[model samples]
Target: MAGSELPQEALWQRVAGRREGVLATLGPDGTPHLSNVYYLADPATRILRLSTTTGRAKGRNLLRDPRAALYVPGEDFFNYTVAEGRFEVAVASVTGEPAIDELHAVHAASGAAGDRPAFDRRMIRHRRMLVRAEITRLYGLVHPAA
Candidate 1:
């Protein structure tokens, strides 16, 4: 779809519905590191939000390198919405205070009530950090076989 006509709501729906996406970051060895993560995407702002443990491969990788990519598969392996973006990492100095409350509110306003129990638990357990990524490029790919 053309950039102007790229229905942000539809894109966000696809993202929120997916369970896993490949989060690629630069490893310490200067190679790509990929991991699966559960994430929240805000269509209006075009920001994808995710949370990680205080210290993990992905987190460490982000610290070393802020550039990252996220890939959400379509119906099949051949079809997918891939986003190449860079994150401005904001580590939470305080713990347990609803990291993405604004985003969550947006979701709610859009009639997209997420997994409440899971969200509550996350709000309670992990320190909230925000990764604001500006989607530099996004495209949908479909292989011939699919």
Candidate 2:
């Protein structure tokens, strides 16, 4: 990684460790639609994944435009990281059983532990889609020591 980019360890410790992030997607008018999203990260591939349904605003925005940014705050104040990348959308039907597991991970990462059966049903009923972001650039002042 370049000096301007976040180190591998910092990426894992801060971005991947966080349960939630603010996702900014482009609206049709080219404005940003920001929303809180529970996400899972793969430090190995530098990809961030989140769950959303096509009926939702963010999902609709992403379908129209794939450009996005994810901002994750550190455990402490005054520190955060931003990952800018293209957001890819995949519906459960295309992804199969793994989509369910991936959506569950989003809920689990968000600290939701109750009513697993109901949650599963709702996810399927809503036609849950997974959003994958491959980090093309990294920003913010989150240090590993922070």
Off by over 4 Å in 2: 1-9, 75-77, 94-97, 110-121, 142-146
List TM-score per model, in order: 0.67, 0.76
Query: What would the per-residue lDDT of candidate 1 be over residues 1-146, giving only the tens digit for each residue?
Result: 21222454555566656746899898998899899876667666667777665478888888778989888987765567777677866665433345556434434554663776565455445544556677767766545441
Q: CA lDDT, every prediction?
A: 0.66, 0.77
- Quantify how close model 1 is to the true structure by its C-alpha RMSD in Å: 6.0
Clashing pairs in 2: none
Which lDDT tens digits does candidate 2 get at residues 3-29?
A: 235675665567877768899998989
Give the number of the best model, judged by TM-score.
2
Q: What TM value does model 1 have?
A: 0.67
Model 1 residue pairs with clashes: none
Evaluate residue 32 in candidate 2 and report its C-alpha lDDT on the 0 to 100 scale: 85
